[model samples]
Target: MVEIAMRSYWNEGPTEVSLNGLCQRAGVSKPSVYREFGNEDGLTHAALENYGHCVLAKVLEILAGEDIFAGKIRKIAYLAAEDGAHESGCLFVKMRTAKNQMGEKTQILIAAMASMAVDAYANLLIEGRETGEWPGNIPVKLGAAYLHAQIGLALDQRARGEDPRVVLALALCVLGLTDAQSEIA
Candidate 1:
């Protein structure tokens, strides 16, 4: 039921979702939902956490695979590109965008949830640098900023109905994860 509500909210955005609507979609009674989740904000908070877990799980799987740093970054870019297919963009970004609309507690929870992905990516970059897969001079802060920028670009392209893959490719090049010369060749 929580999953159903989360998916609906994710696909449609928070403004369009309602507890009654979620109950209908989940095929559960309103009383059952209230008994479990208390209110719309509560449900939304849980949904965001669930969404965050899903995103983090995918990132973990990609990082766990046997691939070079560039390859792993590319894979993560592709995943972000795919996520841009949805209206609200990445769940974490969406939650951040909607922070003002959420309660104070929810806002903090959402921020923490969003931070997890950035932290994971930063840690990956640090590990890569330690292993010589990434440049030793690469600053973790700058790498995290680059990754967040790529995500923003991907979301913008998606909002404009453009191909996010182009954004992803360009982002990789800008981050020095891909060869600019090879792109021209």
Candidate 2:
């Protein structure tokens, strides 16, 4: 049901959601859904929570991997790209664009996801700098802000059918890394 809800939101946007259609898509009865999740708002919040977990897990998994700063950034760029599966747009991006129409719970979940992304960027920069991967002079705060901003741009570009590599370059530029940094990636 969470997957069904996410797919619907990503494809149709929340403005077009219909409870009966969602119940049909999930292969669950409306009464069962209502019992489990209360209503459409509850279902939407649950889906957002699921998506937030996926996003947070991906970042945490990457941070624990052997990849360094640039490699991590590159992977992030790829992940941010809009695949054919999400033809309408990324769930988070779509939520952001249609925020005013969203229920408060859904909005809160989206904000949590964004906060998680920022924390991931901050943690990566902190560890990278300590390990001699990131340039020592740049503050972690600045790097985090820059990385988060670039990731947002990357996701937006992907949604618009542009290349993520350009976003990757902008991210690398923010780090002010050398050509040798590609070796780390």
Off by over 4 Å in 1: 82-88, 136-138, 180-185
Candidate closest to the true structure, highest lDDT: 2
Q: In lDDT terms, how accurate is model 1? A: 0.69
Task: Write model 2 residue lDDT over 1-185, tens digit each, in one string.
Answer: 98888777766777777889988887889999989988777888888777667654775688667887768755665566544543444677677667777888788877777777778778988887888777756787777878776666666666676775566565676587654335323
Candidates in order have lDDT scores of: 0.69, 0.71
Off by over 4 Å in 2: 82-89, 136-138, 178-185
User: What range of 10 consecutive residues in model 2 has the weakest lDDT sum?
Assistant: 176-185
Model 2: residue 131 alpha-carbon error in angstroms: 2.1
Cα lDDT of model 1 by residue, 133-171, tens digit? 666455786777677667666765665567777776765
Error of 1 at 175 (Å): 2.3
Error of 2 at 95 (Å): 1.9
